[model samples]
Target: MDVSQVFDLNGKGAVEALALVEAALQEQRRDEEVKLWFKFDPPQPGGGETLFQPVGRRLRDAIKHGHAVRAMPAQGGGWIVRLAAKVR
Candidate 1:
């Protein structure tokens, strides 16, 4: 899913984005994972590591049941978020 369409790097936006992603995943019939892309603006004050923290927390908190979530830097200047069903 296009995270840009759902999130804007703000607290409220992060919540909304996670909701959308969770809903989408719930509706899917296949076992394929869901991936989201987010492009963040350059870090302000606290340096690079602080950039995606809030969104990352929200993503992790949104997971329920047996889903797994992870976020990592993308090739460009953004983050790649992934969500998948947990393996047994």
Candidate 2:
């Protein structure tokens, strides 16, 4: 499923957005990673790490123990994030 359709948790606040991400993780497929793309308004300098770190942490914490979460800036605008369980 597309991340937007599965996790469409658009909100005005960070806390609300994080909550949506957490909820989405619970419903995600266990065998495959979930990828998400976010676009920032006006974009940010230096990839917007400072703005996205907390959100990334929330995603990591929501996943299964030992699962991995990846977040990085996209070339043109916002961020790309992926969450997946670790291989045993």
Highest-scoring model, TM-score: 2
- CA shift at 8, candidate 1, in angstroms? 5.9
Worst 10-residue stretch by lDDT in candidate 2? 3-12
RMSD of each: 5.6, 5.2
Backbone clash pairs for candidate 1 read: none
What is the C-alpha local distance difference test score of candidate 2? 0.54
Q: What is candidate 2's lDDT per residue for 1-88, written digit by digit as tens?
A: 2453333333335676666656655555556676766544433567343335555566456443544466565554445667675444
Reference-based TM-score, model 2: 0.52
Can you write out model 1's per-residue Cα lDDT over 1-88, one digit (the tens) per residue? 4442323343335456556555654544445566666555646675435446665565566454345466666554455666675444
TM-scores vs. true structure, each candidate: 0.45, 0.52
Error of 2 at 64 (Å): 9.0
